[model samples]
Target: MDKSVDLQHYYLELSPEPVRFDAVSQLTNVFFDDAKQQVFAVRSGGATGIVVKSATDGQNISFCMEDRGTIRSIKFSADNQVLAVQRNDTSVEFVPFNANNQPNVPEMLTHQGKNIIYGFVWVQERQVALISKAGVEIFQLNFEKRTLKSVKSLNITVNWFSFCPTSNFALLSSNMGTILTPVILKASTITKLPRLELGTSQGCSGRDVTLAQLYGTNAIMILRQLQNRQFEVVIYLLNGPGLAPKKSHILRLGQSGRFAMNIVDDVVVVHHQASATSMLFDIALGGAETEVGSGAVIHQPIIPAKTIKPYTLEVPSMSLDGKTINCDLYSQHWVLFQPNIVIDAKLGCLWHVLLKLNSLCALITDRFRLVEFLLQRTEGKPVLLNVLKEMMSVNYSGTMLPVIESIFNKLNCLYKSVLDNELQSQMALMALSTKSQSSKLSPVPRVIVDQSDAYTGVFSSITDTEQLGKILLLYLHSLARNGITANPELSKQIVIDLVRNKQFDTLHQLLKYSALNESKPLACFLLSLSNSDPSISQMALDMLARLNANEIILEVLLEKGQVVEALRIAKQMPGADSLPARKYLEAAYKTKDPLVFHSVYNFFQAKNVRLRGSPDFLKHEQCTEYVQYYQTLISTQCL
Candidate 1:
């Protein structure tokens, strides 16, 4: 057999049968063992298992073992040599893996019960920080000496606990307060710091408290409360020092049927229902609130389920560098969920078959997985250049440009392969996609603006009237084409400048060429201009009313001393009955024909309105006389 076929056969031999834990079972927890290059998942039942696949060879070694009670939590040791299993029965067990270059049976390490394990972290090879419902415990294991010891225990019952990266201290959150304590591994001593009281707010329930990473070195604790029978978000700081109590910054999520929170550094990413929206907040060390992005939903769901349930969905996991978020979505195939994935800010690399597959395209949604895939493919500038060219040709903007630029910059800085041609192409595409011109006719000369320059006092005092005219025209064209609503004063100023520069011809061309119909607000402004003239006004009014603009033409004629001609034209216009009553009556009076007067009177009466005016004036007399004549005309016509 071929070497590849032999490897496949070996893998097939090691592959376990697909075991469905339960029909209603969901994978409640997943831990990626980076050291061993394996993924362990615990389902709702006490089912525990590990899928050990070589990151290089793509070979599978599956292990499934039954544990006592439902598995509440699961984790792998830092070295990936041991797996920790926490059960709902308040028991904790450590399953040790032998690295003896042969198949071996795993041995259980610790079996202690206090309360359900809420959180746990392996501090080193021998020490582990474990949090339970009752409090926090430190356990030490000396494999070299074959000994395990229960170290120190804390007083307060911790709902959750996390260790700081640099110190032996662990952050603990409980119903009473949040505490940071130093871990004295040898002596089993814990020196507790001042407690940061979360206070007695109904929203600060122990179960609803969740943590999310922010942009800085801070983390946010999202406390959900039942107010008026609806869940509301009360955000608090987690990484900062203890301070006096203050009102929590409440976010009115407005009865989100379901929601999920994820922390990436100091940015808290929240996805909620009520409005299918995602929000990012900058968590500060002092507990200050700063919302980053709030609008539409940008990220796509990994598993697009119909109903919103209290289930955890793993998005792309971020790396230590805080740049890329790795994502894996299993569509119809299980192979897609294979591990050995790294999604950096600029690149995503998936190790398959000893080769790295880089993804150079991003999906419309800000899915970490897709982003990582694209980044990996385009981490080299050449790939990014090709993508930029394609995107620019199609006029795709927003997420496309940012993703491309980010990858381009990263590749340019990291890889020497990024050539000038690729960089130039990316820059050109960004300019094309994001550029807003001030003129189309008198197109302004391009002047590169440094992105790093602040836009404070950066007003251009252009001495060239030609350039000014070009800029104004570009601005107007952009407004019309993009449907951009400028401030009233700014719009008026632009129009004044255009008029002063005699750029009406350019303006007229822009109005005619706009993708938006001439009836739109921007188009209306151009039509209202005095220089727009009779022809433009007539066109605009016709488009706005979806009619012949006969009334507008008549008004123009009246202004030019051609009342008789206007009246003649008005009478011939289509849908005469649908014309404004005032215009019909005025045209009838202008015609000075009794029959015309009678028609106007009959039309107004049919519309259920009495002619209002003196019967002496020609206009008034015409209306009054027509009403009487209209009745007789109607009776005669019926007979």
Candidate 2:
């Protein structure tokens, strides 16, 4: 009846001799050279180069020039036969891997002005697109004819750069501080497509701009700005023509520590963290505002041992179809070393099931067949069932029915057996009571000791209340569809017992039933019950907020309007004070209601005190000024 599944899988883990390189700050790039059967790494801060043989072999290679400064960028040629290395302070080198499978002496490529190449991509075996402080430059190589050409140079400051996979179009970040410009390229001709001006340039760190394609047509950029000494993500979408560039939408990710965005087909996978655990959001560029998939941190090796083990092995993976996402626990083996197989079909099947489960109705028959196929082929290998349960909960109408029914049937049978045992024990007690009354020469009382009382006594004998609650949960869930409302008081008592015992699963079922009914008393009771549990309080608040419970919230706030209390609840509920604040302010301005004005002014003062006049807060002066002036007026009146 708990209906929760354990989602754990084995991932490759490697315990290497913690190799540290001065130049190897982080693994910035990874590319497989099929022709050479090798993998190359570009170390960001140091001039050294590290290369490892493909997972097929376990050989390590390092290349460095004592005088080459730091490696700014490195890219592999399309044919995987050549490596292009760009160094800090505007220098380029070409290292060719020879017949011995080792990098040969570096060949100088550029002899130009100080061109700080920030990023580059190998367009073809010959041509490479590079971004510098000056502008954009295209370099070409001709192996057959032995020719190199500078095809074109665009004179515009580019802060960030990325090329379309299938097109000549290159996305350039407008050096107008933080604004972005998309440019269409046709061989030698460069046309600026359009620019979308997002937020003001203030506090925008140009270094944080990351570019990726969103749903093919749109260009997505994630911008970071310093807020309260922390970094937050500001997502921007740019599409359409140069004159009328459409700003699709903007989202403010609260308290995101570090973030990474990668586009796969129509979906964008956003990896971010607010606290200890990393959160993954599978965002559909073409669909609704809500994310398609959500997952939490499962494993992180980078965290220190002193800190809580924030990393779990569950890495959430999104399918290319944009329908399903799964969280998988990778073996420490796979995490450190490359996997032997190209793909884990079992993991693939689980991911497919998660995506299909997103659409419950469509997945019912189709998903069942797919699951059957996986079970047959896999032969009962444990899959990531946690992700499967989350998906099933969302789309639980058609396809979920059979799965839920199967689980429910087993639980129901178990509960019925337990109930039968309870019934027999109660009968035995009544028979004993009858015999004792006759033997003692006492009149037998008409009142009977029922099974509920006997069951309570049996549960009281158990040492662990937690186990007892779990048993009761299964029993309660088995009765969910049997019209428990026929005995509302009994149902209410059962819910209270579960709540008191911290049996959340049963409480959730009861809340679900309460929400389904249209009765006000039931709704209020459910809301109160939800309010009692912190886990369900947000759900209750959202439901009540939808019901336009502004009056109710305001009334409660007036009695408990301590600054801390007001701020705590207000922060949780966006636009919490908007309605009440405006109403009170209007009453004060129009009717000269001192009490109303004082309350409105105090709310504004509370916010000002909390925010402490930050610059970002100052930018929205109209809203801030109105509240400040009203508060000042109240201070004058009180004086």
- After the best TM-score superposition of candidate 1, give how far the Cα of residue 248 lies from its true spot, in angstroms: 8.1
Instruction: In angstroms, give how far residue 28 of model 1 lies from its true place.
Output: 11
Instruction: Summarize candidate 2's per-residue lDDT along 1-639 as a digit string, tens digits.
Output: 121211111111112212221222243444333223345555434454465434334455555434355555555565545667666556666656656545555443552447677666565666766667777777776544444577877777776565554444566666455566666655444677666565565424444554544434544455564546544444444545555354443333445455443333222333343332222222221223432232211121111111111122233368654443332323111111111112122232111011112222222333433233222222221221222333344333454545544443433343344555566667667788464532222222112222243234332333234343343443344445432222344445555566666777655654554422323344355557765676655444444555666445443444333333444456566675343444344434453545555565566556656657532233433445446656677678852
Residues 64-126, candidate 1: write the lDDT tens digits.
666456655565665556667676556667767677322233446665665767667676765
| Cα error, candidate 2, residue 85 (Å) | 1.5
Q: TM-score per candidate, in order?
A: 0.38, 0.39
Best by TM-score: 2
User: How does residue 456 of candidate 2 score in lDDT?
Assistant: 41
True-vs-predicted CA distance for residue 510, candidate 2, Å = 36
lDDT of 1 at 206: 39
Candidate 1, residue 220: the lDDT equals 32
